[model samples]
Target: MTAAPALAPAALRVRGVTKSFGDLAVLRGVDLEVARGSILALLGSNGAGKTTLVRILATLLAADAGTAEVDGHDVAAEAPQVRESLSLTGQFAAVDEVLTGRENLILVARLRHLPRPAAVADAMLERFALTAAGRRRAGTYSGGMRRRLDIAMSLVGDPPVIVLDEPTTGLDPQSRLEVWRTIRELATGGTTVLLTTQHLDEAEQLADRIAILHEGRIVHTGTLAELRALLPAAPVEMVQKQPSLEDVFLALIGHDGPPATAPSGPTAQETAS
Candidate 1:
């Protein structure tokens, strides 16, 4: 029998990845693979160590055990290669407040040693719809605009793998949608993206594969269809009637309402003891 053709190298791979802080174990034998030219969403509640995992992948932190690779280069042994192939947007947008949006982009471009920093910065501002505000200080921009500039800075080197950690956290709905469109376009253009987000809808919309990180370990990983199929189907409620009080409340408050319910059973702490 003929063997199957060797699979193309994955964009990123983590095997038995584990991390700890003294007595506290954060990541416990987590294994994940993100394929080239796809979006992999890492979903979890706050304090689930999603950021920790991304840090390891981005070469910001060292794992206590197991192995990680980016673009066929071992993360530990080939740190520079991994860094060169990956871009990470931290949970908080990190634009320099003192710098104008254009200056920020140019600075990053220069750091990446782009041949023409001004041209590259101009192109990025145009691509991210920030050309209008490019001359303003990042501190003066709206949250969404600042976030967009922060993301634009990360693309200076055009890394193949982009790690976006909650890139849309403070954006308005329209801004969030715009970010989603940009993410989808990147994935379609053959860039692998690994993202961590609490927004389940965003994951369902953009991720080719979804991994639910529960207590640092991946409890679920699959395509949206596969993950959704695991749960009982519930009717999506869209009303032709006038907006309900809840909708009106959210509209007036400019925020999603309080969470609907609490966990039904014992907490993880109770379960562990």
Candidate 2:
């Protein structure tokens, strides 16, 4: 009989991840896993330590306690390997304003020592639908175009995992939707994406799984349906309701209606226990 094959490890893994500043604890024993080729959204409010957790995962900050691994490499002990396996696009677009979009990508590819950087850069520009704008300086690009270039730069390394920190925070509605489509395409193309977002609707539209971080810990981790299940069952009623302005706007823009249902079970604060 043939021996069974071993399963691949998760794209990202964290155990007992803790971080603090002086007397205040920002993260209290957080743990999570992101499967390969899946999208995981880390949902949190302001000052909920979402950014801090992302920084640690990207190897920008050291966790006071606990271990994190990316593509099977320990983040602390094998920083270079971890870096090689993941790319990070922070809240703000990080492209060089003076360089053309194409030049920015080529510069990143060359820095990563990729052969044929020009070819790689062109491919990325085309992939992100920035081919027309590729020749223009990043400083002249619109917010959406610059954001796409920023993400394209991250992909120049061809990393298996990508970390996006509130990527659409300040974008207009149309720009935000464009970025959302781009993110969905990334996951569909076999990239593991871990995104932090304050927008519940964004999480609902993009994530395969959602993890809620409150105070410091993940209070919930599941799909939209599972999260909805946590709420108390509503009584049957027959009532006609008119559509709200938000619903009309969503329909106009071809957006799916509504964010996740409100959770009446233990709140994130209650679930911290």
Candidate 3:
């Protein structure tokens, strides 16, 4: 019998991975894959082990069983290789506060052993819209500016894959939107982005595919539209001159439906019909 053709290397592949902390199991036979240049958003409620899964992929934590590959490098055996091929941007900005934005970038470039560190730093400062503030201490920069610098630092080596854990947590609305745009551009430029976020809207906007984890296991995983299809559409509240039942409901209850719009909630008559 002829052997099956070899499968193409995935940007990231986690197979039956399990992790435990004493009596608690953080990851239970979890399996996931992210294709090259695509965005995968891992969503979960608190304590669902989203961060644990990310840590495992980033080689910051070991799994009790199974294996994972990042950019064709085994996460457990080839951890250094996996670390070299991937970048991790955590919830807090990791840039050096005492260093100027340019200095921070240069430091990272030097660590990555990029030729002409100053030139690379200059280019990155421009790319991240930080040229004006490149000479200023990162400690003095605004939240958005600091976050941008942190992300820019992560790009010093131009790694193929980036794992972001809540890259936009405390930023204002406009700043959050800006970060979203940056993520889009990165994916467009052939970077595989795997991020974890609590923002449903962010996932809806940025994720090519989303996996919702519940209790350390994947409860839902699909394109946003597919996930939406699984859940009924909520009521459409309209502003009109005449009052209707929906209007009365809104006036009395202050919402057309529950404040938390869940996928399994009842569908609006208009949408259900």
Instruction: Name the best candidate (by TM-score).
Output: 2
Per-residue lDDT over 1-273 for candidate 2, one digit per residue giving the tens place of the 0 to 100 score: 998998889999999999999999999999999999999999999989999998998899999999999999999999999999999999999999999999999999989999999999999999999999999999999888889999999988789999999999788766676788799999999999999999998898899999999999999999988998999766554444444564566678776634223323432222211
Candidate 1 lDDT over 1-273, as tens digits, reads: 999999998899999999999988999999999999999999999978899999999889999999999988899999999989999998778999999999999999888888999999999999888999999988998877877788888878888899999989877665565677788888888889998999987887788999999997999899988986897766454433444453565577665433112223333222111
Model 1 misplaced stretches (Cα beyond 4 Å): 1-5, 232-273
lDDT of each: 0.85, 0.89, 0.85
Residue 216 lDDT, candidate 1, scale 0-100: 74
- Compute each candidate's TM-score over C-alphas: 0.84, 0.88, 0.84
Q: Give per-residue CA lDDT, model 3, range 195-271, as digits (tens).
A: 89998878877889999888878877899889879976676553333445534654575543322222333333333
The TM-score between candidate 3 and the true structure equals 0.84
Better structure of 1 and 2 per TM-score:
2
Task: Score residue 127 of candidate 1 by CA lDDT.
Answer: 86
Error of 3 at 186 (Å): 0.5
Q: Give the range where candidate 1 is weakest over 10 consecutive residues by summed lDDT.
A: 264-273
